[model samples]
Target: MAAVRVEVSVLPDSVLLQILALLPPWDRLRAAGVCRRWRRLALDRAVWKHVDLSQRRLSSGSLWQLLRRVLPAGLSTLRARGCLLSASRQRLLSPALLSALGKRCPQLRCLALSETDLRRIPYASVPASLTALELRRCELPISWFHPMAPSGTLRRLLLHHVPAFADWHLMAASCQHPLRVLSLRGTHRVTEAGLLQAAPQLKGLRHLELWGCGAGDATMGAIGSHMKQLRVLEVVDCPVSSAGLGPLKSLQGLERLCLELGEKVAPKAVIALAQALPRLRELQIVGACSGMDEIRLSLSHCSCSHSPQAPD
Candidate 1:
């Protein structure tokens, strides 16, 4: 009898990571501990290109251990895809881990910590490479923005339901970079003065979203006049009207405008917007504002759609 020899080809690190990315969290963690080579490969940033830690059922100690073990040596990008951290569970994320991440991931650029507590963020320390940041439903203090971030690299910023902006002056001063995109939805404390102070710094801005804020016509006009590069302006759930929209007519570069019509904008408001801002490509009117009388607009490159009813 003769013994037969067999051999199997080994997959490359990149290919192995691609395979590991498809596995569940626990399974991936288990695979990382298989061997030294496997552990190193699994911890590579490529394996976490699109991390989704939603409903992972991870304990505080276990989460810290996993982050310490699995996170790559020098990660350049991180996406906390829509993870919810309850008050009690927030303790699981240690300040040490956050600080370590800030110091280690100096090349990190994009961060999406949606629906997580901002108290978890060591605001005093942050990666200099951060450019795009999304903080949704995060409870951060006003002092969080006092620490000057790496300004030259920052571009996009989104803050939703953040009450910490009562002293919005600090935010304006800290955000000195020319932002391309800015969104502050449901930031009740956001005032017109704060926006006015910040608009000049964001001269290169193209998209601005200010929903459910107190900013009226004056604020919009200020931004429209300065941001010559502004393209898309969305001011839904605000008190601004078509008269306030009048200033945007000169914004030859403007493309999209989403406004919520109310007391400030009468039935004749749409007529003025259509007459002016000929470059506007898209217009959306929701809530009570959409009930305005339909005005026939003849524009070749523009489209208009309005909801007769408010969002349910």
Candidate 2:
């Protein structure tokens, strides 16, 4: 019998691309070296749509180099962290590299970065295509992010443990974009005035979650008054009062309500919420499951002190 000659080199580019997609990012790059055909297939935009560099112990130098080579123009989602940059340099360098990243990946939508300073990132460089952004455990200035894109594009934003995020920042986002969902976890500095100022302006907001915030009347009142289109509201371990819950009656569109209070709170607020939100499909009281239908009220067991928790 004659020896069979099987050659991936002769395979169709589409077929080779399908095979390359199955390999990990590092391995795919290795396969690219096998032949020019493989190199072409590996660099295809579809092959690098979602890139995650959290696993690699990459330095800013190597990260910059990688962005220049591997980052495709049509990338959609990216999660990068693990690069340890000093505060002073991070502010200067991150925005430039991020700008470069956005320029190459114009179609980029979701960007999540941790342990990085995002303050210095130029507003002009932010990708207009972004729909969701999550910044966790970053040291940033107050209202560092603005509406770099046009109206009604960015819908979801999550700020976790970011000290600099205040009323003006939220207001800036509210005024610029029609945000649908917003999450504030471990952000403690935002006082009553900031919350009140920013809350009512989110006309398109549907979902809002506040965790580990002690902001009492100011926070709740804002949600009650301005979050008219809100459907899901989660207030966990906050010092909300019956006085604040007074505004819940105005939220006719509200469907799901998750409320948690410490042992210190009287049952007055809970009773008021139960009465006000008759349309609630899911309800959680003090970390307990009290609703009849399919309800998701996951509560964090925050003790006496929980806000502004450092990221692990």
Candidate 3:
């Protein structure tokens, strides 16, 4: 009764559109079916600027319908995963669909695909407007990691659990951009040499993460020498110690540092880092709990993760 009494037409188009933009792709479709006024406002191009359909699967015909009905031409970022994109396959999205998306969404700036089959993606299929890309657990060709990368536009690249990813792959990738962030998690094959080779290319990188991947002092040294503007550094479940990490002192802007030691790091190395990164806001250290009490007590402000887990 209340919904009927309140005429939605009286609500400014801007307010209704804002409400529509906040809904997920599935819920947004449901809201559009509510009434004619909402359908008009929901169809506004700006509402479809960023569409993430990572949780649902759709048939090729269904995809075409969704694209025409809800996806606007002005889409800037599109994230799709677990989708039945091909008409023949129940769980695979065809490269043809990917190509169509790139063509239709000219303004697309960011693309993230996880748990998707990217077996046949072609060269130049990604829109040139893209600046950020994240791929995880996908069946992608090695060429997509290098030759197909949007060399001129990409500024941030993240690869997580990509079986094809390796140290040499990063070595071959286009490194023209001073990338802002390079996160390679679950890419165990990448090592010190691979990161070192790519470090020089990503001099402007601010956030660096090597989670659950092997890393050593050389990797730390490479990062320190190249990424001088690095702000956040997290190296979890990697074989890294305080020895080579001393180079981090060169980073004047470093704010947060989290290290999960895989080897016994020297105490002096920890002290060096504390003395070097004076502007640090949070410093978390795990696995080297033996002689860290004095160091932890000295830098009371910095949080250290100790055995049995220390208080926050």
Candidate 4:
């Protein structure tokens, strides 16, 4: 008997699409040239819903070509990290490209741009349908967050190492956008006063993370007073001491609390936090002092019925 022969073309379109979906973005693009059927399956909306160009060194022309030829209108998430960097002082993400993106990809929901300069790009050029935006180590305009409208769909925002994110931008974001989750790291210019003023306006915020943002007792107090809806809070490398932890006790809705403390915060403060918040489910305390062993022992011996998880 002759040996049986098998071909990928024998597979159903659904199965072929499932196989193609596992390939990398560039690999999928390459696979599209194999055959007409394969091309149609490779360019299916389901296969290109999320495109990550972080690893690729893309120029403006190549990006434009990809947007026009490869990226589907059903694309929801796009992460372009360090893809458009140039040695010369030329903007890779021109207004025309941004406008085309907005018009072409109406379903774009989440966009993340890292290690890219957006100082020249108008804030209004950002896609209006985005529910999440992440900008890391990017040079932003002075009024980046000011153009966001209150009626926009943006819910989550992460700004890492964005030094230009000042109090005015924070205030504008708090007032204009209905953000539910906000993370700020290495934004030292945002003072405690900024938190005091903006915390109240972020009534819908549930998860907040602040790292090296100069938060203190007053900032915590303001959060406890205004941000009653906050469920998860992470404060790392801030100026908050044991005294500052007192205000956090009033956060009845808080479930997960992470604090990276220095010598100023004592072991007992961690115990107090574990016992104070009624809804506290997980408590992570990273002490930079020599009493970390003692802190662990104290936390282990604490009689709080909540039984907070051990620090990670």
Which 10-residue window in model 4 sums to the lowest lDDT? 303-312
lDDT of 1 by residue, 1-312 (tens): 899664312767767878887776667778778898777766667776555554444445655665676666556556553335555555434466566766756667777665555565556555557788777676674556553654455688887776665536325433745578888788888777777776667777889888877778887788768877888987877756666877777677778877776665765666666567767778777666534435434444567777654333
Candidate 3: residue pairs that collide: none
Pairs that collide in candidate 1 are: 60-92
| Alpha-carbon local distance difference test for all models | 0.66, 0.68, 0.73, 0.79
The reply for model 3, stretches above 4 Å from the true place, is 1-11, 59-61, 83-88, 147-150, 174-177, 266-268, 288-293, 300-312
Clashing pairs in 2: none
Please provide TM-scores, in order, for all candidate models, with all chains considered together.
0.77, 0.74, 0.85, 0.86
> Please, what are the lDDT tens digits per residue for candidate 2 over residues 1-312?
999998866788788778877667788888778777778788887788887765554456666877789888888887766433664533323666777877888989998777666665555566778999888776665535565545646789898887777766776777777789998888887666767777766767899888765467667766777788888887876745557677777777777766665444445445455556656655555443223222222222211112232223
In TM-score terms, candidate 4 sits at 0.86
Error of 3 at 98 (Å): 2.4
Give candidate 1 misplaced runs (Cα > 4 Å). 1-27, 30-44, 56-60, 81-94, 119-122, 147-152, 167-170, 263-279, 289-297, 308-312
- After superposition, the stretches of candidate 4 with alpha carbons farther than 4 Å from their true spots are 1-11, 83-90, 147-150, 289-312
lDDT of 4 by residue, 16-128 (tens): 88888877888998898998988898899999898888776556677788898878889999888653356533445766788899899999999988777787787788888
Q: Compose the digit string of candidate 3's lDDT tens values, residues 1-312.
A: 555577667878888888778889788778778888777777778888988887775555666667666676799888877542443655445666667777787788898888766666653566667789888886666665564354566788898888778876676553644478888888878877778778887787889888766577888888888888889988876756657677778987888887765466766677667767777878777555566676676665566555433222
CA error at residue 104 for candidate 3, angstroms: 1.9
| TM-score of candidate 1 to 2 decimals | 0.77
lDDT of 1 at 65: 69
Location of the lowest summed lDDT over 10 successive residues in candidate 3: 303-312
The model with the greatest lDDT is 4
